[model samples]
Target: MPAPKISVIVPAFNHEAYVVDALNSVLGQSLGDLELIVIDDASRDGTWDAIQSIRDPRLRALRHEHNRGAHATLNEGLGLASGDFLAILNSDDAFHPERLARMVAALDSDARLAFSGVDFIDSDSQPAPGHERALDYASACARCAGQPPASWLLTSNLAITTSNFVFPRSLFQRIGGFSELRYTHDWEWALRASTDTPPLWLPEPLVRYRVHPSNTLAEDDVWRHIHENAYIQTLALGGSLDGLDAEGACTALLHNTSLPPLATLCFGIAARRLADDTALRALTRPGPDGWFLRQLAQATGLNDGVFRSARQLADQQSALGAQQCLIDERWATIQQMSGIIAERDAALQAQAELIEERAQAMAHMSAEIAHRDEAITAQGRLLEERFAAMEEMGREIHARDQIVSEQSAVIARLMATPWNRLRRFVTKLRH
Candidate 1:
């Protein structure tokens, strides 16, 4: 008998509900030159009995004395694997029928390519809201250009699950086995491997990563998520202060641990110094139900930032109003000049009529003079009333001008305060 070309390793620990589905997915793979190794990490459940139910001769099963975590169990499975290639699949997740076949074909096609796999289901295992089902390779290239192929091996949709995708045994040994990371060791492994040789990516979404309550990435594991994500950012950025620019890196670091209320409070403010809005949003959105980001909002006067942007937008609008006012003032001045010219023309016409009447009505001079005097008196009273109304209107305009000037000054003062200083003050107060 010859050794199998590929060994699919599954580290099982009380995954009775989903482990069988995961195993069956492998057994059904189009590539049959494979061995399935299920190492039960001292599960208290009927995991052992469950393994006994499977009668495949190629299936090799083992048991641990106590519950070793996935990292340890995976390393043990690697030692037991007899094939040239290693595939790691979690007990709760599974592969599509063509996953093993496609991955093997890809690795066989390129010598430099150590591993190859497809996009798996996302964290929800459903299409993201507003996104269509069946995202092709072209769409993926557009989403994350220049990112590693294995990054898309999201644990839900597809993973280099110890079972589905195969990797060269030599490369696995060179990079060292999976670290004893609490939650994010797989991401760390992918990042480390890509530094030397990038994994070959197949654009198909061939892995069905299951989303269930029993999974390790459940929302309740906030501390674990924070710790793992923080460590991962450190590794990804090569320990540079500039490395914090890696999206969601700083906020994950700041909020992951069970810091004192004040310490966590202060760090939340510090997270906002990240000039990237996308990173900021990621930082605020917490693990699982996004509780951490909410906590971040409450801790750091994040509403203040929101208010500031709103106020600035308002000031810009006010400035636009002022510009319009200036245009209106110019228009009013033109109207006043036109009104003066019309009033002068009317007065001249009235004077000409008075002179013609005086010459024509000399015989009835007394009666004509009396009528002309009455007309002049009425015109004088009308002019006096118009002058008084114009004076009152000027006073009202002056009061409104003062109010606008004061409001504009206040806005300018608020805009002058440095945002950085304000954030630092908030952090200090929280600390």
Candidate 2:
């Protein structure tokens, strides 16, 4: 089979929940004439299972028995690419369906463009928050008419990720693959590749960049990232100035980032060792001491070490002042919180008093109800006794009526007899 148009390299790790969607995003892209190579970097989770579950003819699955870092894995994937164009998709991130198409068209249009990049989405697959300042900075640089792409990139990184990169395989061969910096590798690569011309910066978001606890930026090696950024800053603004106008780039960088003096910004890379190469180089004549910085330290009756010590002391004093300000703010907050607590306690006390009053009223009502209940019970007993007496009287009346009826019947029978009739006639003649 002929080689695909693009070779998409995915360096996978422990992202079980997200790996499948990432692969699906690649396979389901609008531009389908691309090959996808996923190298599982010895993930402990079910990320391999998720990657394996994808059934596609364009996919080539690979696995690492031991976990190599991201840069190494990417280089390995790069070696296996057969396509003219190359793209990288981080395991936890997804792609816009039309990303490859848009990027390819831009690259085909301009040969001088280092790569093609677009805006990105966050973990929710929407425009990320808290990036307004960075976005504004990049947008402002891009809007500067007649400026070279390198000048636009001198202030801040435009295309933020290797995941955002879509360039020719030949460019990858020239500038090489990712560096060892876990946090700022993408930024370093962005600066290195864009030294001549700017990448195609499409303002529209075409990729989902995942930001979570597991990101390389969230790693514990903060000093390493700082050192890496120091080197990267050196590449852009350090000794050689990386083919940029030194005065203009330095002013813009300082204005944009509010960074320290040129010497400190270039040399004071916060790596673990204080006497590292970069720091020592700052003491050289051409670095911080040459141009505007003469033997002013000796003029002030202090050597270079003493001058450095004085600067350190001043920095400590400033830090202490900041700490004091924070403490004062916290004390004010504590006072405000105390006031709120006092009001809450007062309200609770009022509620307690109201509850006590209600309890007393309820007790009084209960007693009154008991008293009424007792009275009603007594009246009920009296009515029951009266009813019993009336029933006895009715029985006696009934016996008397029966006796009178019997007596009347006997008298009527005597008057109806013949002897009674003759006696009545003799009594009438005598009268």
Candidate 3:
């Protein structure tokens, strides 16, 4: 019964869709001398079933009867892990094939380096945009080359997330494992661990971190994360900040403006707790602190003139943003009104064209009616002339008939007269 070279811890909750892929990535690693420890934190989904389906001897699956948080699950896995080195793989995230091999090699080569670099991937298991390559660990370290390890870590968590961390198991015992936190446990652990031994930077994308809607570091949890970060900073600093060399630490932190706002605020809190007025002044003297930092300052009773100035600046920025929003709305309304006016103009133009067409049609119809009226008048005159000619013919016919009747009567009278006897006597004598 020998311990594996590496112990991979997976804190799965509701990652049934991706848990298989995550498990496969770990079990299929090129370096086979590793044990996979998956703790199901009472997932309501089929994540537990998926974990059980994997039939590997090196795989150790644990289940919580109740829904324990991720931190508890991790702590349990750490306690049960039987390996020389430790690695964490979120159930929703996966690793490249060579991730375990590469990270182990990096840790083996350097005793002081706690972990290697990481790469981000999207939900589709593809490399995230702007994260095509592994993080520029060398450049980051080079930026803090001469600074103390504590100062560098206080400024930034060189290893971005737990998924990117693969350290010697002994280091966990030295640092007392992860703290009990709802959020920011990984960050807190990194802050503490890196302060002791700086992490080694492996400039290759070994892990595939999945970013999706269900990610724990969602925007809505920002405040919670900030609160936890401040708490962790306080714990790290203990009751006093004397050991941190507040002046030097503040200078180092301020030099890197790229540090997250939360980390900077944490430094401010530490300085305020220590009553290092000079450090506090230096930290907040950069014109204006952001709204969150200002709130932190006020909470810690560090609201001096510097804080007031920052509050005023924040108020001004907020007012400007409101004014800009109003301007945009007004501009949009004007554009909409302009569009409406243009549509009305077009409609009016169409109506005008229609009116013109109707007028032309009416004019043509009137001309046609006039032409028809003239034709009717000419026909009426022709009918009157024809009637007059017929009347004249009728009169002529009547006169002729009267004349014939009179002529017939006269012929009859003459025949009955004496001519008849005289003519007849003469004719007989001649015959």
What's the lDDT for residue 258 in model 2? 18
Write the residue-wise lDDT of candidate 2 on 124-228 in tens digits. Answer: 555654564336545654543345455555555555667877878887788877766566667767766665555677656677777666777667753343335
Clashing pairs in 2: none
How many clashes does each candidate structure show, in the order listed?
14, 0, 0
lDDT of 1 by residue, 38-155 (tens): 9999988887888778889889889989888888898889888888777888887777887877777778744323433344444445543232322432343444344433333221
What RMSD does each model have against the real structure?
36.9, 14.3, 9.9
Error of 3 at 337 (Å): 16
What lDDT score is found at residue 128 in candidate 3?
71
lDDT of each: 0.62, 0.70, 0.71
Error of 1 at 419 (Å): 99
Question: What's the lDDT for candidate 1?
Answer: 0.62
Off by over 4 Å in 3: 109-113, 130-152, 232-431
Q: Please estimate how well model 3 matches the true structure, expressed as its whole-model Cα lDDT.
A: 0.71
Sorting all predicted structures by TM-score, with the top scorer first, yields 2, 3, 1
